[model samples]
Target chain A: MIATRIIPRLDIKGPNLVKGIHLEGLRVLGKPEDFARYYYENGADELMFMDVVASLYERNSLQDIISRTAKELFIPLTVGGGIRNLDNIKSVLRAGADKVSINTAAIKNPDFIKKAASKFGSSTIVLAIEAIKQPDGKYFAYIDNGREYTGLEVVEWAKRGEELGAGEIVITSVDREGTGIGFDTELIKSVADAVSVPVIAHGGAGKLSDFEEVLKNDVSAVAISSILHYKAITQFQSQKDKLEEGNLEFLKSGKKYSKIEALTIQEIKTAIASKGILTRN
Target chain B: MTVNLKQVVIVDYELGNLFSVKHACNKVGLETILSFDKREIENASAIILPGVGAFGDAMDNLNKLDLAEPIKDFIATGKPFLGVCLGMQLLFEESEEFGAKKGLGIVPGVIKKFPKEFRNKKMRVPQIAWNQIEKPENVDWGTTALKGIKDKEFMYFIHSFYAQPIDRSDILTITNYNDFEYCSAIHNKNVSAMQFHPEKSGEIGLKIYDNFKNLIV
Candidate 1:
């Protein structure tokens, strides 16, 4: 049995790590490097750093953080957000990202996937699709963190992405995102069924069962943020003790943390294993 | 015997993630040099070809940098030569990635795409996940870099195509994905390559690199 990947997604806004519900209400968690190292130490199969505001900002601050993390972390690192052109892709890969996920940019220039995949390799390119369901129950691809819409449906878009040389497809549900309700398994299954490349199910994972439900489908990996991050805090009981000494002050005294019980990567793997799903232990 | 302190050199042909491989080697206390210079490769105790890109483009870069023949020459020296991912593919004779491209030809094999039958069914093309690898029938896992790693241990893989070695005996391990079992690792004399990325496979992965470090030492 193949080991399903349990990935920790760190959505970055400038230098700080931020999280939001439905891709809004941006809250800074801490430094990207700190969060990245924590996840790596805790058995995160892979790490995804999405620059949530790279399009709005003038400068991309993720390169330095990725470089620093790659120096220490051996697992594959994927950097997404604001990757628009060949030069952008080149610089990110050169900066030490094993793969680059293109969402808005690929939608804007569909041929960019082909060009990037050809120049670099299909394995190095991942298509990040943000899907939102419409009134008719049809899912359309959204861009810019689900703020905008492309008329194209997600399943069709994922197939096209694979045809265009994307090695993997990352399907993130905008409607279910940040809600911690659960994963949109239907959406995941639909896209995973449509594409031959590996599909990573992202957004709206709230519990252990959430992971199991999605993994039972064709999802190759799960891109989780809220559950993993919150779990890390609650499991440790306090941020002061859980976090490294240098970054202790990142969590302010008056700030409220998620009361939801957290689970570690090992715990999640064990839960998945109990369900008869094999994962890297 | 003058022991070489710097035991590994990750060849940089301007293609894949070279940093992580070097980082993995360093993590295991194996000194490495990320070099494109032919002389550096010739002088190193071992050479690691790590890449992720189109087969045609990678070959083009290696040819452009004139490191292609140097790589073959180094392999002939019988010092351990490890090929990772695309690097593993490049060790073969040719690839069907982009209209039939030639590889370094160190190993008698051809790089091929996963059939659409599996693609149309349960398995994905790239098979991008952590998958278990088992030793070839009647072969000890010790013969390859997978030494000390338990059987069926998971390693990270991210590729659509797999290698078909001309000699079945050259295959060190096989991984089952979908309805097919494909060669996951190849070992021939002092040359070895794996389709999986040990650098991205975590602690067990680092242990594999550590084993390779010891093999060369």
Candidate 2:
């Protein structure tokens, strides 16, 4: 089932979860724990923390955030960035966070994914990718926060991560992040089409309609910060419900909502054709 | 009023997250103690094994603390004992996922490596991420613990090579992929094992632990 996940992507720049695009360009926001707790209660499928530190902070402020988050929130948390070694992954996971996501580290050491998965579990590891749309229409996975191109194809790496035992693949469009231009549909479809593990689409969600569009492309989740960051989207809890009502297939949260099945690709297309779906503003 | 006896002892293997496991038991209105002491485990009514980490390291800690034999004897008494993921795998004879290490051998199986088969399958081993699951059959769904939950309900799962139960009757539920029909949950009288982390599986996961909490035979 396509589980509609509301994930708050927090950009951590020492102690505080800052937000920005590519590299060290981050603006200070509220404390990570406070933001995490808000999302936890309001309805978040899961949470992901992107460590903006170049993997070299004296004190692991991001870790401090994770430790704090672990105390207040009971939901699963995926901490990424600067996770170059097994020890980096272990520290946060041991602090009570559920999963540890690695991007550049996994690329530098393909063995990282395999080791972490075998040591921990595949579910506890996520391989983060940012694919840039080339002039040739092929998406190349970028690393080091989009500063350098890994020169590897998105589909190939996805297959590799799965082989390496990466439980899930979070594919973000580096070209689209914070641009709010809209998510890279063809790129997501390509990666999602390549691997069976769940795929999360990040970058360029300017409106709620964008979420619908991405889910329509068959991504397991639509991750947003800007739209929800402002009063533009009055509520986040209803995001999941809206997807359910629109006939998109999703995984159930179990306790809180009615056990309605999410719409799969065939179901979604059929619903659209049969006038059972609409573009709600 | 929870003036009742504490029916379960959530064994803290010291890898991580002991209280979360204990808290799940508490939500079910069952009394549970976080015990690292050998004395308390032997005296407790039931046992819970909760852990998260490397197989070899976890086994090392369990061995160093010298709590291994006591745990085995406690389970031998036929009281309800539940193991989550690494905790469950540790109940086996040996694990090949890492170099080569031994488990408690409480269950007559060796933790082998994830088959080269997954190398060609859609499922990535170290099966991280949440996925669909078939409803557990051995446990009664009528209990309030599984109140809103139904068959084929989805729960979070994270692991690589799943335990292949020697006794077919011991298999409780399963999830499938291209060529994988993983043994999701297992049970043998008073002993229950889950490949998924019930403590981290969100509410449905928490509910399973709650069911385990109320399971006072």
Candidate 3:
């Protein structure tokens, strides 16, 4: 039995760590590296850095951040957002990311996944699918942080991605993102069952039980953003003086999100592990 | 030849995570140079072969740079040598990734992929999760780079193909995944290799580099 992975997902806007509800109205947190270091020290299974606005801007700014963070933290880092070509993937890997997740480019050109997997090895590529429930009760794939819809069904797309050589898939529920309502287990289970590769569940997750609930869906890992970020902000207390970009007002005005309950990575892992789930200690 | 004794040469074949491996070595207070120069690798006190990519491509890059012979020669010197992830797989004789591909043949083994289906149940390839490293029978870790590390310590792994040493005595540590236990690390005299990326395994992983640094003298 493989140990369930607990990953802390950090959404970055420029240099500041940011979070948004349903992938909109972004609120700036403190330094991403600070939060990353904290999570690593506190027993995070892995760390994910997603540049939330990289696609709209058509450029990634997290290279420097990834480099700096990779030096101190010795954990697997998966980077996503605006990874368009082989060069982009190469640069990120050179910056010390173990894997590069692709959502937009892969949807635009499915063959890109095949080329990347063959060139960089399948395990180095991750297919990220943003899904939202439609009126027909079917999940449709969305891109650009849930701003654009692709019309393709989530489960079918995940299965195609695996056939195209994606070593893993990360499905983020646009409807549940940042809501803290709990994971879209239905969406996760559908994708997990459709593909043989490992699937990582992202978005939602308000409490510890939320993790246990999703793990039962057969997700290889759980990526939580607001839950861990909020807890970390209160615990670490961002130094407002060091921040340079994004909306710093949130940091200045007591970082708190009423929609989600703050929970540490260790707290979530211990809670889930007690319920007969295997996790890395 | 006068070896630096403090600096470790990291073979750069343009396929692996040279940056993180070099960074990890630096964190452990060891000087490192990312190079493919034959003379540099041959003269270095220790060598760390770190990679993450297709086994065939890795071998092609190494051979293209004329590094195949130099690496084998370095190991023959009996100085500390470490292989991580694909780098460890490259030490074997052949791999089944994308059809049978030849390896550096330093250790007697062949790389095999995890079964797509195990016991009528589908198994995920590229076991991209943290798994434990347990000691084999009669094998004491106190004398290897895993020294001071706890038994069954979790290390980060991301690979589809795993090494199966023809000589069982070369097996250093084993890890269980998909209802199958496979050799995850190997130690034979001078060569020590791990399928997991110790450079990305956190504090416990840094301890491996620290132990490797201690072996430099």
**What are the clashing pairs of model 3?**
none
TM-score, candidate 3, is 0.97
In the order shown, the chain A TM-scores of the predictions are: 0.92, 0.79, 0.97
Poorest lDDT segment (10 consecutive residues) of candidate 3 chain B? B1-10
Question: Residue by residue across A1-281, what tens digits does model 2's lDDT show?
Answer: 22345576877666554555543355444455656666665556567887766455534667777766665565677888888787887787766677777888888889989988877766678889888889998888878788788889889998999889888889988887866677788888888778867778888766444655777764656566544443212233244342312112211232211122222223323433354332100
Interface RMSD, every prediction, one decimal place: 1.4, 4.9, 1.1
Candidate 1 per-residue C-alpha lDDT over B166-188 given as tens digits, one digit per residue, 9 for 90 to 100: 99989988998875889999999
Please report how far candidate 1 places residue A189 from its true position, in Å.
2.2
Give lDDT tens digits, candidate 2, residues B1-217: 6465557888876675575676566666667777779988887788988877677888898889888988988888887788877788888778886577888887776665555445454443445445555654555545433445666665655565667667667666676643466676666667888776666656667778667766666
How far is each candidate from the true structure, as Cα RMSD in Å? 3.2, 8.7, 2.0
Ranking by DockQ: 3, 1, 2
Task: Return the TM-score for each candidate structure.
Answer: 0.92, 0.73, 0.97
Indicate the residue-level lDDT of B148 in model 1: 84
TM-score ranking, best first = 3, 1, 2
Can you write out model 3's per-residue Cα lDDT over A82-140, one digit (the tens) per residue? 99999999999989898999999999999999999999889989999999999999999
Residue A203 shift from truth in candidate 1, angstroms: 1.5
